[model samples]
Structure formats: structure tokens, C-alpha cells
Target: MQKSVFLGALTVAGLAAGASAAATLDDVKARGTLNCGVTTGLAGFAAPDANGEWEGFDVAVCRAVAAAVLGDPTAVEFVPTTGKTRFTALASGEIDMLARNTTWTFTRDVDLKFEFAGINYYDGQGFIVPRALGVSSAMELDGATVCIQTGTTTELNLADFFRKNNMNYEPVPIETNAEALQQYNAGACDAYTTDASGLAASRATFENPGDHVILPEIISKEPLGPLVRHGDNQWGEIVRWTLNALIAAEEYGVTSANIEELSNGTDSPEINRMLGTEGNLGEMFGLDADWAKRAIMAEGNYGGIFAKNIGENTPIGLARGLNAQWTEGGLLYAPPFR
Candidate 1:
């Protein structure tokens, strides 16, 4: 009786979820576009290019998903959202998926009712200060004015870290990274705190990038990723597997240059399965067989996206330290496609 009751409850939950998200895939197909939520002008993450085209690491994910679903990389409506507005935009169905640098946490996952598909970037909050400030460590910033983004985990983390360290700070709250950057540049705050990657990305945009120094003390573990509202399993699965396809494409040596040839056939059965040469995995997901191929060919793989946007060659100059492939001593490992 207990087992049957549990199974019955699960069925009801599944049915509810199905009803909620059954229209997402169809709506996206009918509308002929994917609405993706992104940050409000964060360089190397989701900023517009010289031609006003959205281009960056996070933007690449949106493009890939659009290609996978609509068979066109350009079929995306990039919705710029501030930290305060991103969740509401996604939950209200104003956006299909959120690719902004949002941290996944317990309150967000359970209380707010969103599903984090996977970790796109593993980051930690840190502080940045002008070299002229003469502060070498975060411990010395007692009573300092700190610029922080509102409606983010960074704010909570900042409060906890200061209280735990027996330090105090005056928070200069802002809604977007651009505002925080302006305040930090104008000396409105003695220090600016955010994800270490964000600090670096922001600093790279300044006129004198070398003047700002990121402190070595990283205070919080921020697992940043794309998320969708709860009760949207089918829509969630499309976003999840689309990300997995990018990671898997990197793992299996599939590049945009040779993807066409590999799609025809490959000696490795796993590669063939992922590229849709020898399996109908797409059928299981209610998508065509060329979905993964379209996604990969739209941009390259996960590594390609990172390198092109924020890698060492870029102004952001982030190393593939924690984001490298699992075989290369990093944590980016995708599940088996089969």
C-alpha cells in the first residue's frame, strides 16, 4: 500500500509537470524563436558586439539551443535582465531559459522552485580594489564601502563573510554589473565584490585594467548555470541535454570543422551515438536526429565557447583551471549520452 501510494503521488506530480511544460517545446517551435535571459551587459559573458549582435560565452549557449531546436543559430531573442529581474523573467514565462551568471542554491532550487540544469561555471566571490587603496587582503577591509549586486547570492555571502570574519562593511547596492562598475570606477565604494570571474571580466573592460587588483581570498562557492522554472520537465530536458551535448562534443573530439564527416560515420560507437549517426537518441527527446549536430556546428563545443569568449587570449583572460575537462584534472564531466 505504501509503495503504491508513493507511485500514485509521483504520477500526479508528473502529470502536473507535463501539463505545465508540454506547450514550451511546441510554443518555441511555433514561435520560431527562443527567448533567453542574460545579464545586463557583462563583458565576455553576454554583451553585444560592435554590430549589436549578442556574442559571448553565455550567448553561445542560447545560440546553440536555438540551433538545436529551430535549426537556426540566429533564431534567438536575447532578453537582457538584471540580477533583480532574471528569476521573475524566467518564472513568468517571459524567457525560455536563463543563461546569466546565476548561482544555484537551496532557496533558489527549492523555495523559488527552479531547476539548475548543470554547472556551466564554478566560481567563488572575491574582492577587487584599486592598487592605490594599499589594501592587500580582504581582512583589512573593515568598515570599507563595498559595491555589491542586489538580489544575488553575492549579497548574502558578503554579509555572512563579514560577520564570520568579525569585520564590517557599508554595502553600496546596485542592480546590475554595469552600475556596480560605474560606482567602483567613481570611487563610490572602497571595494567591489562579486564572482571572481566577474571581477576579472569587469576589470578587463576598464581603461586601466592593471590598476584594479583582485584579492586572493575567495569567500563562497558559486555554482553558476542556466536554470528553468519548476514543473517544466520537457523544456528543462531540452536545455539540459543541449548543454550536455556541448560538453559531450568536447569530450568526444567533435569539432565544427570535422562534424560533418563524423556525422556520416565514426569508428567509435559512442561518438556515432552522440552525433546521431547510429542511434535515435533524438527520437527519445522528441527532437530530430540532427539536433546535437546543429548545436555543435552552431558554435563549437564547450571548450571552444570558453576559449573564444573569456579564455587567456581574451581580455578577460580566465584560465581553464576549474573548468577544464575531467581527464585534464578539472571538473567538467558530462554524463554518457547513451
Candidate 2:
């Protein structure tokens, strides 16, 4: 009787969550804008420009989703969230989806009742220190003070990495990347730890970026991506496929430069289906035929977005490494659009 009662309650809870997720789609459509949660400020990932317009790799995902759903990429309100507030904002419906640099963990996915749409960036935790510290590797810093963002997986990873190595250290807790940068620059911490990509992003903003060197040790696997509340399977699918559309676009040679022409007519059946020329896939998500087309046009495909924001040429200077296309020896492989 206890098990049966618990199962019943679980089902009811799931249905309630699903109802909320379903309503989010309608609410966004009715309001004609997407409320997307983003980092307070992490250059090359998500941050405001001099014009006060949000633009970056992560911001592109939010714009693509807005374009896919509303056919207007600009129809979005970017909500700045710190590591501590991001999940709460998403859970409270303050944001329709979260496009922050959040890792997909088991607890956040199941226990926290959230669903990661898909992995956009394959990252790992690393450390950055001033060159003057003479620390060439993470293992060398035994008693160093570390600046870590609170309410993030990095905190636990920081503790675990040190404990496993039998090292002792002092932690300087911070809430945002800006704070970590300020504290680290002010000598409040000996080292700053976060996703390797983030370290690069933060370092790029330094007065003399070459003054700091990121350690060689990659401490944790952080598959970062967008996420939505669980039990909202349909909304989840919309976000998932929208991201997939961008990945598939890159793999199939559908770029922002050629997407419109290809959408009109393409030789590849997969491209045709994805661009909504040969199938009713959009109907599956309650969107129009040109949904994926609009998404790609919003900020180009995944590779394009990456190159424009954090690629080797950019100040953040990230390479395609693991984020490259599956056909090119990376981990990015999108399911067939058909």
C-alpha cells in the first residue's frame, strides 16, 4: 500500500509539472517573447555588449530558440542570473529556459526536476593562476588559495580534486565570474577555478592576459548546455530539436549564408526535411515549416556561432577540439532530421 500510494503521488506530481511546461509554450507564444536566463557576465559565453545587447555563444542558443518559436530572434528578454539564482529562475517560470553555461548533472536532471536539452559545449574544469605564482600545474598548488564560484559543481569538484590529491587549500567563495575576477585580481585568491572555457573567457578580459596561465590539468567533465524543467517533454523536445537543427545544419553544409537557398530546395532529403521543405516536422512541435530555417538564420549553425564568439580568432580563443562535427573527429553528432 505504501509503494502504491507513493507511485500515485509521483504520477500526480509529474502531471502537474508537465502541465506547467506545456503552459510555458503557450505563455511564451501569447506574450511574443522568450525569457531566457543567462550568466551575469561571461564573455564569449553570455554577456552584454557596449550596445547593451546580449550576444555570445550561449546567447546565440537563446536567440535561435526565440527565432524558432517566434520567428523573431530579437523577441527575447535576457535575464541575467548568477550560478545561485539560475535554477531558481527557471523553476519559478521567471525564465522560459536557461541558456547559461550549466553542466548536465544527474542531480540537476532528475533530483532537481530539470531536463538538459542537449550538450552544446564539451568542457572540463581547470585552474588559472598568475604567471608570477610560478605554478605550472594544478598539482603544484598544494596550499594555494582558490577563488571558486558558490552554488556550482566546481565547488564540489574543487574539494574532491584536492582531497583526492591529498592537498590542502583555502577557498575564497564568490558568486559571479565578475566577483571571482575582481577577487582574483585583488589577490584575495591564489587561483581561480571553473570550466576551462570560462577561465579562457575570464583571462581574455585581463589587462594583460598573458600574465596568467591556465594549468594543464582538466579536473572534470562538464557538458554544458541549455535546460528546461522536467515533465515538460514537449517543450523539452522543441528546445532539443532546435539545437539539433543547428548541429545538423553544420554537418549537412546548411549555413546561414546558404540556408535560405537550401530551404527553397535541396538535393539531400535530410536537409529538405530539416529545413521544412519535405516534411511536417514543424507540426510535431507546433511551429511553422520555417522554424529550423529561422533558427539557423538567427545566428548561423553551431560552428558558425562558435567561430564568431569563442573560436581561435576571437579574444577568448577556443578551438573546435571536442566541439567539432562528428564527421570531423569530434563528439558532435546530431540525429537525422528525418
Candidate 3:
């Protein structure tokens, strides 16, 4: 009958929608590359090296994900996205995930139809001014020209901070961190405002890094992370657990140097499950048993990545304050592998 055919058609449509919802993983496997969105260029976060090889903290996440899914850490297309273009790139499927210094906010999470995989960096908005400017505090910047990245949480936070202090300032909006650096260096803006970690990265690139000082006040909490499109729960879980694997690896003392040895077997059940020596954890996410192992091996553990790229010895010189493991009195704690 016509009614029976209509019911069957509805069932078929539902099945098709479900399939499409989980399509990213299969698409990525077929393509053999993970398109990862990152910042245009931020020192110690994401940027090309002397030989034009992409290398940095955020870049490592992209490489790790590619290794987990594609079995090759180098199988990644790093799409450079500014503050405005990053979201659109991810939404349009131009990129599989965004690993830029994007903050996890209420509207961005709920209204933007994106799922934040996890917080990679706990950050806060702050300001930097040249030491010659004699501005020791953010409150002293009333009526100053502030260079801020457009389409970011810093825009609103800058407004709120000034408003709270009964201050007013001229906004000098820039699209990228590089532009902000240019404008601020050229005296187009009196101060540059962004995440504190970003300020450190920027200052490290300055000709006279000692000539500038980041203000003491941190205005807004920026829980920066990687994000994927919302509908693909399977893909989201893969990315989420990939990052968790790195964190847990660091917590359990599994470094790149030791990961292979540990993978042979370990005393800890959690380590065994994570490294695929025990349990079907990777199969649960439709991947091979060695997915997490590949991810960990690709970039070393999260702690290793941090220490190499942005730690005190690096140009960025960011101390592991809030980003340290929970057992080390920091905010990082991953779920059990089992």
C-alpha cells in the first residue's frame, strides 16, 4: 500500500541521517589525511620552522590525531585560520578539527553547533605594553589604544574590563596575532591584549623581549581547546580520547622513549588498556588497537610536548603552572582507560 511505502521511506531517511552523522571518521580514513585548523602563526603554538615544516604545541595535537587515525603523524593538512575563519572552516568541513588557541565559551559551545573535545590550555586574557609606556597595570590603560583580535572572547572581555574600571579606550582590531604584533610594534596600538600564554609567545618574538611587560591582571578565563563538529559523536569521541590518552600517558610516566617498552605490557591495568595491551578500547571507537599508542608516540606525552615547545627552557618560557597534571597540583586529569 502507499502508507507502507511511506513508512519504509521514512525509516530509510532516518538510517541515512544516522550514517551521515558518523561520516567524518570514514571520510578521514578514505582520504588518509586529517585536515586540522590552526592559527595563522603563533610562536611556540603553531608556525612553520626554518625548513617550512609546521612545528609547535598546537601543531603536535594535529600530528597526534593524524597518527591515531591515519597511522602516520605527518598525514595532516594544516589549514591556517584566523580568529574569524577558524569556526567557518570547521563548520564547512574544510577542516576535520580546530586546534588553534580557541577558548571554550558558553555561546561557542551551545550556540555554534560545535563540540569542544577538551581543554588543552587553561588560559586568561591579559594585556602587554612596552616598558617605556610606563604602564604597570591594566587599570592604567584608560583611553589607550588597545590592539585586540577580532571575533574572539578577548574583544568582549576587553570591553568588560575597561567598563568595570570606569575606563574607556579606543579599540584597534586585528585579524591575526601577527598583525597585532606588527601594529603594536609600529605604535598603532598602545597595548596588545590576548591570552597570557599568547602574550608570552608574542613577547618572545620581540626584538627586545625585555622591553615589554605583561600586566599583572588576568581579566578572563580562557579554557582553550580543540573542537569538532557536533553531529559526529564517534569522531568527537576519537579526538577527545586521543587527547586524553596523551594526558594519561604523561600521568602514568609513558613517554615517547618508554611508550614502546610499556606497550609490550605494563603492571597497571589502565596503562595496558590505553596502550592496547589489554581491553578493546580502540575498537570501541571503530579504530585499531594501536590508535592511542600511535597518538602518544607521535608527539610524546602532553607533558613532553609542553616542555619541549613552551616550557621555561624554550623561547616562550611558560612554566607549567595550571597545566600540570592533577597529581602534580595542576588542572590536568584524564579519565581511566577502562
**TM-score leader:** 2
Score every model by TM-score: 0.96, 0.98, 0.95
lDDT of 3 by residue, 1-338 (tens): 99999999999987786677679999999998999999999999999999988999999999999999999999999999999999999998999999999999889888997999998899999999999999999989989999999999999999999998999999999999999999999999999999999999999999999999999999999999999987788999999999999999999999999988999998999999999999899999899999999999998999999999999999999999999999999999898888
**In lDDT terms, how accurate is model 3?**
0.94
- Give the Cα error of residue 333 in candidate 1, in Å: 0.4
- What digit string (tens of lDDT, one per residue) describes model 1 on residues 238-315? 889899999989988999999999999989888888888888988887798899999999989999999999999999
> Could you report the Cα RMSD, in angstroms, for every candidate shown?
2.1, 1.2, 3.1
Pairwise lDDT winner, candidates 1 and 3: 3
Better of 1 and 3 by TM-score: 1
Candidate 2 C-alpha lDDT tens digits along 57-78: 9999999999999999999999
Model 3: colliding residue pairs = none
Candidate 1: regions farther than 4 A off: 1-17
